[model samples]
Structure formats: structure tokens, C-alpha cells
Target: METQDGAELCFPQLFNTSCKKPSSSTTQAIILYTVMSCVSLLIVALNLLVIISVSHFRRLHTPTNILLLSLAVSDCLVGILIWPGEVFMTTNCWFLGNLTCVIFMFVSIIIISSSVGNMVLISIDRYVAICDPLHYPTRITVSRVKLCVCMCWLCSIPYNSLILKENLTHPGRYNSCHGECVIVINPISGVVDLVLTFIFPITVIIVLYMRVFVVAVSQARAMRSHITGVTLQLSATQTTKKSELKAARTLGVLVVVFLISFCPYYIFSVAGDNSYTSSAGFFVFHMLFLNSCVNPVIYALFYPWFRKAVKLIVTAQILQRGSFEANIL
Candidate 1:
């Protein structure tokens, strides 16, 4: 059967039976899957370390760090639970039975929805802290952050659960290995899922970040004015202003990286007209997978403390290994 993107494949037939031998497209898919798997695993490992280190070290447990830890945990779960099935679907084939297919697809949808929702929460958190600093302390308590995280997952459940049910009930006519489930292409359902998953969340993120940018700029200007009024005193006020500017810059970097990694996939999914051609689907899948692997690097670049922490952790690990070797000798 042909997918929406125009790649050719046999469907309703199991992977082993679809073709007598592996094809070039299959080889490419394998390579892509392998590379993505390795990258995602590396990202997961690093993020896990970040989470653990932050939790263990007293100095690293600020509210901002707590949000970062949550993001890292989500990414790690995505890497562990979602990426493996993705790799299998990309490389070997969809060999899992119907139950697994539903579970995998359901979990993946939840993870993705939660990831985007968490980003929205992060943006809102920053926006409130920067724009309404006077009330931020009272507004952004630990309980509130926890509630936000819980709400994200709660919001995700219905969307993913519906999609999962649809995939299981409506096996596409051309589906190879009818055992594996996929979202059936009903235009209405597709449009709803697209709007809920991509359109609304993306709009929220953009609006919140825009507000954040405006607030940041205003604060910077006010700080400059206050500094001038103080006869160009460059110590306390200047340092505080500089730190705020740095934080704003870091948030900007994060927003950019997020958009860069995920935009293509969303755009393609929204515009592709539901054609499941193997090539286009595979290409978009790969891009989405890349998104899961990008957060660590972005964090390192934007957060100096996180960067230093990672460095210290790595150095300590190396030293410990050396000492152990010496003892063995």
C-alpha cells in the first residue's frame, strides 16, 4: 500500500511478508532510526543526570530549577517509552500485537502533548515572573507549579485516549499487518486533533512569549533609566539588570530552539493533507524525533548554572573512574 507521502509499501501484509528482501528505503529507515535512537538515548541519560544531580544538590533546587527538572524528566520518559517503538516502526517493522500498538500510540500521544503543554507552562511562568515581579512570589508557589504539571497531563489524556480508541477501532483498509493500529483518516477527526494539539498550544506559547519579550524589554529600559538617574552607578543596579537581561536572553534561546525543532513537523502534519506516503511520514517522524534530543543542548547554552553542573558532574565521574582503576591496580 502507498502512504500519503508517496512512498510505496505493501500493507495488510506483515513486515517480513511485505517484501522478499530489504529495500533501499528500508535501509535508509534503519540508518535514520539507529542514529536517532543513539542521540535520544544520550539526551535521556544527560537529562536524567541533570534531574538527579539537581535533586541531590541543595543549591540547585530553586523554582526555576524545579521546572527544568520536570522538563528533563518528561524528556527522559519520552526517550525511554516513546523512542524505542518509533525506532522499531522505522527500522525493523511494526511487529507488536494490536494491544501493544494501541498502548504505544496512546503513550506517545500523551508524552507529546505533555511536552508541548509543559513548554507553555514554562513560558507562562517566565512571563509572570518577569512581567509581574511584584506579585510573582505569591502567584507562583510550589503548589501552583505542581498543579500546572498535573493539569497538563490531565488535559492530555482525553485527546490521546480518543485518538487511541479511533486507531484501534478503525483499521485503515490498506493497513499492512492489520494487527498494528494507526489513526484512521477521517477529515473531521484529523482537523480536531491538529487544532487541539498544534494550533491552540502553539498560539498560546507564541502569545505568552511575546508578552514576555515586551516585559523584558521594558524592564531593561527602566533599569537603564534608573541607573542613569543614580549618576551612572554601575555596581548593584547594573549587576541586577545584567542578570535579568541574561535570563531573558536564555529564555529567548529556548523558545527559538523549541520552534526550530518542532515547527517543521507540525507544519507538515497540518498541511500534508493526510497522505501517509512512507517517505513524507518517515521524514516528518525523524524531525519530530530530533526534537526530543535537542533540549539538553539548549539548556546547556541558555542556563549557565546547568552548564557548569554538567561539567562538574562529568569531571567528577572521570576522576572517580580513575581512582577506582588505581585501587584495582
Candidate 2:
């Protein structure tokens, strides 16, 4: 399984909990799990709708939108395959047997790895488009975007595939009866995954975005200088200034969303290997999982087009409901 650094560090403690006898307070656990499962389902549905809406509407089919659609699809799979099973196991124990367990674990790993990889790709795409406008069009063509998506999947395949094989074949060392299938953390492998999945990609995103901000600032300054040189063209300068300001605001929002969604999990994981056993660790992990649901809501609230679409859909639904009520009466 693709355990994040926090999970890997904390697995020993979690494994201990899993091995304990079944609890009688399972009803409470069940209720909590069910609620979370429903929430996850709702998020998956919303993201799926967003992806479909973007795909079907010709206006939303740009390269950035395509990348977002791919992310939604990946996250949808994660929510569907991983979250329900997680909810089930948390309350009821592992009832799915070993084969299904292996499959579910494999799927979870693949989806998470793919999702993170897609995020990195998105950051790179944005960086190029924003910072290197002259070359972006030639460099980031449709075919090239397709290739990048393909490459992300290709990179994820080996980690998920090998872990699945290991789980199936190494039954002596591994136990699936407890309802958890995770990679046994070898120090080297654990470090490698942490660096590749979290450290390296995050570093790249930070660096690229920082460079983009610097470039944007420099361009704004240069534009101001040009405006002053051209006898203080206030109208053109103001328009250009406004556009630059909006771009900066958009990038700022993106960075904030990314940090809010991902930073806690990474921080908890990296602080210390022993930190995962604490109650705080579990809370942080759950918080990270919940972040998958945030992107659609963020889009709806922040982007005018998405906000309009959401309003239209909601109004139509309400009108349809009212008509049904009247007919029934």
C-alpha cells in the first residue's frame, strides 16, 4: 500500500490497534465511519460532475481544465475504492477476505500516487504558462499534455504493482486477516517513497511557483517603467496593471489551497518517525483525506464561471422539486 510518511511511521502503532480484539463500542465507530463514507461519496459525486461538465462543455476544455479533469477522475477513484473500504474496516473489521483486500490496497496506492503526480504536473504546467508565455504555447501542446498524463501513470505503476506482488506472495511475513494491507516499511524504501512522492515534487512546486511570482513581479515593474517612458499612459497602464494583479491573486489562491490541503500531512510525517502513533497523527491524516473534497468547493466559490454553473444547477434542481411537489399536491 502507498502509505505516506506519517502512515509509514505510525503503522506499528496502528497495526497494534488492528490486532486487538473487536470492540463492543462498534456502533459508535460504525456511525462515524458511515458519516465519513457518505461525505466522501458526496465529494466524489461533485468532482465527477465537475469533470463531466468541463468535458462536455467546449468552453472548459483547455489544457489546465484537462489536467483538473484528470485529477478529479483520480480522486474520484480514491474516494470510491479506498474510503468506503476504510470506513468498513474501521468499524466492522476486515470482512472482505485477502484477495479483495489486496486489490483494494493496490488500487488505493495507485490512485494516491497518481493524484500527487498529477498535482506536480499541474504546478509545472502553470509555472510554464505563467512564467514562460513566449514558449508555453509551442511547448505545452495537447499531445504533450497527454504524454505527461501518461508518464504520471507509468511512474506510479511499478510502486503499486510491486507492493501488490509482495503482499500476495509474502503471506508469512504479512497478515491480511486484520483488514489492513500496507507496505512494511524498510528504511530505504520508506525514505525513497517519502522523497519521491512528497519531498521532491513539493520542492519542485515551491521553486517553480516562487520563480513564477518573481517573474510576474519583474514584468509588472518593467511594464510600469514602459508606461512612464511612454508619457504616462494611464489607461493602458491601469488595464495592464489590473490584469497582472488578478493573475497574482489567482496564483496566491492556488498556493494557499495547495498548502492547506497538503501541508499538515507532510509536516506530521516529516517531524519525527514516532509521531504517527499519537492521536494527533490520526487526526491529521483524516484532515488530509478530507482535503480531497475541498477543490470543487474552492472552484465554485472562487471562480466566477464555476460559481455561475453551480448556481444554475442548483436553481434548476429547486424549480424541478417545486414542480414535482405541486403536481403531487
Candidate 3:
């Protein structure tokens, strides 16, 4: 108690109850804030570019890019809404009060759950396109994909509300002191969240991608082998096969990167509450958020249309007539 008494309180007026200000040095805080600020800004800007390119360009519109568009919007929201609030909570104290806290948690959960759902949808789309090419066209149309996206978000509302019901109903109920706003869940709830958000979705992604990888390798081998047939028909089949493989590879890279970033955060969750809120946990959460920034980079690397669109959008050429119909693909 005597040692703790020397520590500065976040809310000095709170007397014995306020949390002590974190013992990080001024230099460390500055550095941390700088890095986080840069990351937050990059996420917002990159995802904004994705949003504009997808929304503005008609030729780029496809079922798969539609899912990417949905994910980018959620990522943009993470930058705009989650980052500022997180910056405040981590650096300073929770001065925003209970209501804001409740809303923040609610929105965060919804967006995150919806993101996981979107990933699952993306994996399924890829799976069908690759493993079951014949049915993919009729099965995974624009209307159906859009419906799935909407349902994913709509379902998140009730699902997360139930998960966070206590926090919503009784804001600040889990805080240990005046300045803290941590959300605490029991082991049961933690397991439930893990199974729903991380366990099941990740399992589906990995399994589907693994299968896709094997089939892709075989298809690549087949592409190399000679096929004796009529010239025009053989060329068309080769073109179609090449297109499917490219789509699979691009989305495969995206999924791999996502899993690498996301696994740590949830792995820590399974480690218990202490680990979930620890400094290490905070770092993993940052890694999870890092996925948002990495996504547009992936698009830039793999998608030619994204690069062309970025070029046009940057020069404000997207505003010109017939720009939407430009041969971006």
C-alpha cells in the first residue's frame, strides 16, 4: 500500500479508488502513441481507398470483390471508431463514462463478429469456385452474396448483445476502479466467444484453404501437361482454368495473412482473463488490428484492378464520365 501510494492516480480526485496511471515512461508513451497513430491513420486511409474503388467502379463489381468491400468497410470502421476510443482507453483513463463504453463494446463486437462471418463467406465462395467450379456461378451470385453479407451483420446484433448483455445492461460493472473500463467475462462466456468467433471460423478457413491448395497444385501440374484438342476450345479451357486458379491464389494469400494476425488474440483469450487484458494481450490485439492495414496492401499486390482503380481515383479521374465503365479488369 505504501509503495502504491507513491504512484500517480489517473483521477487524483477519486482518492483511494482511482487506478494508478500506467508506469510507462514519457518517451515510451510518445513512441507508442506515434506508432499507433500512424497505424490508425494508415488503416483508415487504405480502407477508404478500398471503399471508394469498389463502390465507384462498376466493372470491378463481382461477388468476391463485394465481400472484400464489406470487409473493408468494417476495417475502416475499426480505424475510425475503434482506434480513437482504444487510444484514449489505453493511454489515458476512461473519462467517457458508462454509456459510451457500452456503445463502444457493442459496436466493436458486432463489427468483429461480422468480419469473421465475412471471412467464412469468402472462403466458401472460393471453395465453390475452385472445388466445385460448375455450380459456383449459379450458387454464388451477387444477390446471394449480398444477402449473406446482410444476414451476417444482422445476426451479429443479437449474438453479441447476448454475449455482452451484462456489460450493456450494467455499464462499468466490471471496472475495478474509477478510471478502468475493462469488460470481464466468465470462463463459460469466454469459451462460447472463442468457439463462435475464432474456433469454428478459423477451422473452416484452414480446412477449405488446405483443400484448395492441394487441388490448385494438381491443376497447376495439369496445366503444364500437353492437351491434344481443337485449338480454340483448348485455349478457352486453359483461360478459364487460369482465371479460377488466380482467384484462388489471391484470396488464399489474404486468408493466410488474416489467420496469422488473428490467431494470437484468440489464443490469448483461451489463456484466461488475465492473459486477455495483459500487455501481451494488448500487443496481440494490435496485431489483429494490423490485419486491416495489411489487407489493402494484399489487394495492391494481387489485384490489377485495384492498382488501376487507385491510379484513377488518386488523379480524380473517377469523377469523369464513363469512368465506371473503364477497362479496369
Give the top-scoring candidate (lDDT): 3
List model 1 lDDT by residue over 171-199, tens digit each: 44435543334444466767787888778
Q: Estimate the lDDT of model 3.
A: 0.84
For model 3, give the RMSD to the true fold.
2.1
TM-score against truth, every candidate: 0.79, 0.75, 0.94
- lDDT string for model 3 (1-329, tens) is 22355877878777778887777788988998898888899999999999999888887788999999999999999898887677667777678887787788688768878888989999999888888888988999999999999999999999888887788888888787887767766677778989989998999999998898888888877877846544787778777888989989999888888889888877777777522245785677778888989999999999998999999999999989989888898
Clashes of each: 12, 0, 0
For TM-score, the strongest prediction is 3
Q: Which runs in model 1 stand beyond 4 Å of their true positions? A: 1-34, 169-174, 178-181, 228-241, 272-277, 315-329
Q: How accurate is candidate 2 locally (lDDT)?
A: 0.63
Candidate 2 runs further than 4 Å off: 1-21, 24-27, 163-165, 176-182, 221-252, 263-284, 311-329
Whole-structure CA lDDT of model 1: 0.66
Ten-residue stretch with the least lDDT total in model 1: 320-329
Which pairs of residues clash in candidate 3, taking residues 3 or more apart in a chain or in different chains?
none
